[model samples]
Target: MPPAIREGSLVFPKVPVLQAAGPLGLCQMVETSILNILGYATLVATNAARHRLAAGWKKKLFEFGARRAQGPDGALTASRYAYLGGFDGTSNVQAAYRHEIPLAGTMAHAFVSSFASFESLKPATSLLGPSFPNAVLAARDSVFKLWHEKNFSQMAKEGELAAFTAYAMTFPDGFLALVDTYNTLSSGIPNFLAVALALFQEGHTPQGIRIDSGDLAYLSREARQQFKECEEAFNFPFSALHIVVSNDLNEAAISALNDEGHEADVFGIGTNVVTCQSQPALGMVYKLVELEGKPCMKLSEDVEKTSLPTAKAAYRLYNKAGIPAIDLIQSASMPPPVCGRQLFCKDLYDDKKRCFFIPKAVEELLVLLIKDGKLLQPLESIEVCRRRCITQLQHFRADHLRLHCPTEYKPTAYATAEVFPHCRHFPEWRKRENCAKQTRKCVHQTLTRNRGEEITYTSQATTNALPFKRIEGSAVACCCRSGETCEPPATRIPTTSERCAGNQTQKPGLAVPHRAMCAACECGQCMPHSRISSVRRGISKNAGTPYPRVRACRSECRNSATMTIGSLIRHAHRRR
Candidate 1:
């Protein structure tokens, strides 16, 4: 996995988190632990931050993912990370208690449904409604009539109303209702309003309403409109009520809600928050940069996968506008950047692409988290981390943090020629480049040398021990014993002309005789088949497209089991 940069810092395609010079074994041993710790935490935190950003800054964002998390430990981890990523609170009680995060959520659908069988008071049977005749009873009857029009089960609606009444009686001050168990508009809202109005008469303020299912934005708006009318008609205290929406909300859904103009006062986000539904892993990794005081780098065909080969100090250089102009990584031995001097930093891959900045502020990014194997810095509070996250996000440019097609913010190395003159990465990079050139040169020479001749360089040993059959027209290096041939099994199938002419001369549809085919060497060179007992196909020079394929000799001629024409060419090129 790739390393994770600090939050709100300019993120690019590939960015290193930390670089150090230390013993190889010491650094390598802790790689797995480093990856495990940062991977999920960073992903969850980033996801939570995105959701917070999508939901307006003023709106309440609650993390309710504990129930859906892997386990109790996972729940706590998710809750802590979510809190640090700008979540207002978490529904996980243990997380709240442990992390000192604010706790929220009063009840679920089960709590409301528990009172479904309770008896309710009607206008005719009870003095409660008729006692207030023209004022309360009139408004209640009107609202009930409107709601009852679309409601099919009067009994079910009554049950819901009874449930609301039971909840209000239990916790009169905390009267928020989950209003989507049945029909939200027809049954839930009306029943909730009835109980809410009663609480208001007793000089109690109804907390709010929650819509768990349905079009949340539309439902919230409708519910709010109804509450406003009820406030005016019944002269009840409903104006300050909060409308909460919770239905598997993630960043995209929250963004859509904001765009469509939702009336919801709070969002209870769950699955996507803890699990990081969109991107589950952060791909954070710890790699060895330098060992034994000497710069070291991992060699790979993929440059992005390779790590920088030195102990480096990273700094954020702020421009005149107080925005980060560039993130500069320099050799640890170099002096910290000064404000007045011009800072020249170049892209690590493309040396020509450089940026010069006269920084107003030069702030070092890395500090001693641990010293002498003991932690130097104290663990930060969730609130402190959350505030820091927000502060960092404010510094990040809007263009760099867009939901789609974010602009890349590539970090540059300061004075690469001077600082990294003896760095291991450059030499390794040049070595690979040279190896490629040599491979190509040897391949060209072999193809030219063996052309027009029925090359038969076969080894005397293992002549009868070859497992795979040498099919005359086979494009692939290896084949089944049946002598039947087709395209290579891999994605690298050679075209018709290339397949026919790859090893030996095949006149159109005519198969070249087995003895006439080119024999591959122990070192993977293409020669006459007479010197080699058996041969297998080598790596294709042009992957997926048939080109210079050097079959490796099956007999013990060189180091390995077999060699390829490509390998032979590489060997030849290296010798020269």
Candidate 2:
């Protein structure tokens, strides 16, 4: 039976269904996020030692020992890698002044402490700003969480919660406020949500909220519920608020959060990220893997011990359509991809091309944090980054993909799978035999699976952990380039005739998306929960007019197909 509609014809529960599958650009924040975590590979053993190839066992062990020789001194500086990568924004004026990198950070519980006794409040705020003007001043949830009337008055005076939003308006790029510091998913959630409803709260939303303690899944769910609750309580709709993640955040943990419908803006990759609790140091080393004259390579039984015999900088190649095609690592000798995907694709899989070049298209630092401790440029306020991110996501199209189906940074090809540094090494005697066996295994595995689409890049390092050295005189491979451009494979979708069997005069009724959309329909666009204003003062089509009774999506035709990037990708996959 057709599921019966409830409430005599309102949009009903389509909201939850829609939110389940919202926009794609909303998920990918590669440049901003990666920069926040890449700095710490400067020294020493990592939490997890790379066990690359079993064959080069002895040499691999020796190489690992060599790495330890850099010893305890480097460890001190190595520990600061995360900070160098961008996480140490604890009002770290020094780090900011040093690396010429932005010391990105938010406010702490101390922000709330400033409001102590109102007498010292003004000096307190001034001191707070001067104390850490470089850091993005994120306020904590010190204003609310009160059950008393006077507390509410204090909230009004301090506008602590409101101040976060106000601070965003004036200093949009200001460090974010700790939105959920006080019962993040509950009381604090509603107040921030109250700001957005009906209108396209499309501009900058909340600073950032810390999801302190709770079943993140349930907390995210409750967060949505509370927004809905406020909209209902005040009689309107609302968008989502900025949420920062604190407790436990890693790749897997991040996946869980986004999976549970939580879209945290920034992740304070503390404890775990800094500790490298799982896998220790990247074991990155700068060595003369190749010297001026001949082809050099390390022969080892341990795959990780094998190092690519060259030094090269990585490059990003884009298709004609400007989509990221592949990642290329090339030495000074290698000619840049002049025309086509072949050279780019080859460079993408080379062992010497392990390091990824920073992507230019994605949102990145518009201003450097420091230059010789003399603040080279003002750090972009957090709001600037956030808005740039949103705009990039919207305009950049497929540049944003799911984590699982990430826009791959295909490495350079032709680079041998010789281990560089993270793994182990083996004798040439064992390596030849092992290589034969591995090649056999690879071929057998490929044949057995017959999946026809195994993503095989000519191996970079045979194993995960191996000794690494920057190649100073590595003979550069100046391969000839195929003079043609890579193209964004045109995905021809179904024609209207193929989709509907006949030409229609017009699209009638609500867009019956190929799959139902999660965003609320606003002026024909789907606005996620974070983009709408609350019923009180958000944008409205029926502005100044009396509230119109909510009605069913007034479409008579039961058409099932509407256009969307996701559906098109799915359809393309089905055809394949």
Candidate 3:
């Protein structure tokens, strides 16, 4: 067995942890974990065009696709199968909505192109302004160029450059050109810079330039030169313009071009960034695994192909250095991966456990994601998230990258849990067998088998993984607010058990399903009646899993007191 490694960044799962971010150390640790998870096998986009693509799923050329599915529910199975994988955010709005996700983008440059000039764009911009200030820029880059002067003119007309500056603040300051339509390096930039200089003189600030075509490198150089040369004429920045590099931009190509000090601000990539163009479309199909209440997962030949059974949450453990060290797939009731991390065992009916881990910054991202659809807080704009991605990519370790030879971002989980990124297709060629099963078992019994004859399975964890027993909230990470315990009422106790099971004789202040008998108790005692015994018993409850904190008396009214299993469970349920 490995020595108990001291621990990395540890995060406590909130009933939803996405609301507030973990600490910087915790945040980095989490980010590393998920970056690795997503970086693993990858959620590749197959549809390079029309936001739709052909998937690896088999096509059944049944003389007739489906003349009629059985009566709605009867045929629902086949119907669901047909469109099961061929869905996009737009095509499957229901899916996105249910998952608390928004559909992919609609309206594109094509839509904006229909408008011939800036004047044409006015009505639309005016219509969208109250809600979407950036819509104008996003829709028509060309219209922006032609009427930008007018836009500045409007700002100057409104009052002074301040309004224009303020207006620009809401709008991303970058101004990219469809440089290809006209001369990007030659006439396009020179003419545009002249206009920009004219605007700057009028009090409008030109943010940056975008190069859409023509030997991006050459055009970029030309654009820079032209902008610099015309600075006196336009008063444009020689150093500050962000050149958005688009046109077949991806990690590799960008790296090569970036090495040359290519001039581009932000990338205006479309199909590639949005569509995952390089990866052929194979729909990422998700099913209701153990819906309502049942154990389930797709049983693929590859064991790692499965998922977390039932309702599970994702978390990351950060190293002491504040970098993510692993990605953990845990159940709702599991304890975080602190020293006393709990493991879910079905036989014991563990509510949660840390099922998976990877050496990367992934958890931070997960924490930022919405939980129970209740966001920790309103998130920053997409632009902020995008900027973060760019910033993080710049600092990430290179080895964490596996562009061509795609592989699972290897992670660590419980010895009993199914290992992930297990070469499902090439088992003989691979050799990671910490928890790899050598023999196949009844997939039904384990729900580990897939359509193919393989023992792939979702690892089922116990509820013990969840943070349930803390006095007020989860124990994963504490507010540690003052760095010292605060003074409490004479009745208040410090232990988690005591906190939940307050003084039963006291009034039930809040709805603490945790300590049922103490429903009236507000004093921080493990149990109102048991408070006296607890002092003698000592705090013996384990940290992570929900173990019985208080021993119940045989009599509901409680005359004599000994540990009763029924009382133990009753006290546990009260905390809920």
Name the top lDDT candidate: 1
> Candidate 1, residues 1-576: lDDT per residue as tens digits?
112244433344435564433455766777787678767777788887888778867899889898899788889999988888888888899999998999877567776666644354333433333443233334456566644655534634666766776666666778788889878887788877777877777677778988899999899999888888777877776767999899899888888898898899999999889888988767665666666567767767876677676677788888888887788777777788999788666677764466566899987776656555665657666676788788877787888767778787787776444345422122112121112211211111112222553322222122221222232443124221222222332222233223222443233342222332233321332333433222223323322322333333334334443344345555333432
Candidate 2 positional error at 461, Å: 32
Higher-TM-score candidate of 1 and 2: 1
The TM-score that candidate 1 achieves is 0.66
Give one digit per residue, the lDDT tens place, for model 2 in 454-518.
21111111221122111122211111112111122222222223221111111234121111111
* Model 1 bad stretches (over 4 Å): 1-23, 120-156, 418-576
Model 3 lDDT tens row, 159-227: 111222223333323333333443354334443444344344434455655555567766777667655
Error of 3 at 291 (Å): 8.7
Global lDDT scores for all candidate models? 0.62, 0.33, 0.33
Candidate 3 residue 458 Cα shift, in angstroms, is: 36
lDDT of 2: 0.33
- Runs of candidate 2 with Cα error greater than 4 angstroms are 1-93, 96-209, 224-241, 263-266, 289-296, 308-576
Error of 3 at 461 (Å): 33
